[model samples]
Target: MSENSINSARRAALGKFGLGLATIAATGTGNLASAETTPTSPHPVVLDRFDHIVLTVADVERTCEFYVRAIGVKVETFGSGRKALVFGRQKFNLHQLGREIVPHAHRPTPGSVDLCIIASTTVDDVIKHLKAVNVVITEGPVQRTGAMGPIRSVYFRDPDENLIEISNYL
Candidate 1:
């Protein structure tokens, strides 16, 4: 395909994901990776798994409470009441909206993240647990493509309405 048509097609695809060309232009990340190609021209960097991710929420304690009940994570208080939801190999630092720590996102908005998490338990068991805790499953026990391969996922919303997909690799 011609470059112009390729770019136009990419823009259309991104638009379907609610990502506008403006978002791409603003970030200057237009020429990112695609499933069809690997952009390995740059030097490959060796890296371990993610240490943690910061979750911006309205109320830290409330978000912590919901994650604890919904996902079985242990909530821990860190420096100066900073909260984190700790799972086996993942930790999410809870940044209470306006009171975010330094060097955070440009606009750390709550409910902006569609986070996909790998669960240790079966998706069916997770659905039952979610129902038991009064958490509404938005969608799934459906199949989806994950980073590693096929995953069975159940979707739900956090306290801040962040879409959470709990999945098990199949």
Candidate 2:
């Protein structure tokens, strides 16, 4: 898509969901898409250590398995019956109700946001480990420029279409 088209779409989306975007940003819950890089509203900020990240999945069980066995997270369902998985100190909760979520059908929008997984071990070790487990690796064990400058990392995907980036910032 052209730059103008992208900008127009983002502006339209932001206008439509301005309140929701504000809520997410205020809570430090997730990333929000915006146009023109406008300054966000100055709400009282209550920053806390991130506890979990949530994603909607079509099949909760399938997502559970991929995260538990493939990506190596501890999977569990709460007494309230909510399913969640944790990997590398990050927790991800999967909800089946997302099908009713607005813009739901347009799910898995690639390039929306990249989820970075920090590792203390070498990136190569992670690549080898995933390969040994027969996990499909879509990309990289190469150096890429990051916010902190260049770093080595590997990229892959989970069953629910989340981009997973593993990097050792050494």
Model 2 TM-score (2 dp): 0.60
Candidate 2 per-residue C-alpha lDDT over 1-170 given as tens digits, one digit per residue, 9 for 90 to 100: 86456655664554424533344434444443432244444444423235776677678888787766655789877747878887544587666743433444355432344687666667888888889888888888877644333458898887656788877544
Stretches off by above 4 angstroms in model 2 are 1-46, 97-113, 145-149
Counting clashing residue pairs in each candidate, in order, gives 0, 0
Instruction: Quote each prediction's TM-score.
Output: 0.74, 0.60
Specify the highest-TM-score model's number. 1
* Model 1 lDDT tens row, 71-141: 88999888987889998656999998898899999999999999898776899999999999999999998
What candidate 1 gets wrong by more than 4 Å, as runs, is 1-44
Error of 1 at 97 (Å): 1.2
Best candidate according to lDDT: 1
Worst 10 residues of 2 by lDDT: 30-39
Any idea how many clashes model 2 has? 0
Which residue pairs clash within candidate 2?
A: none
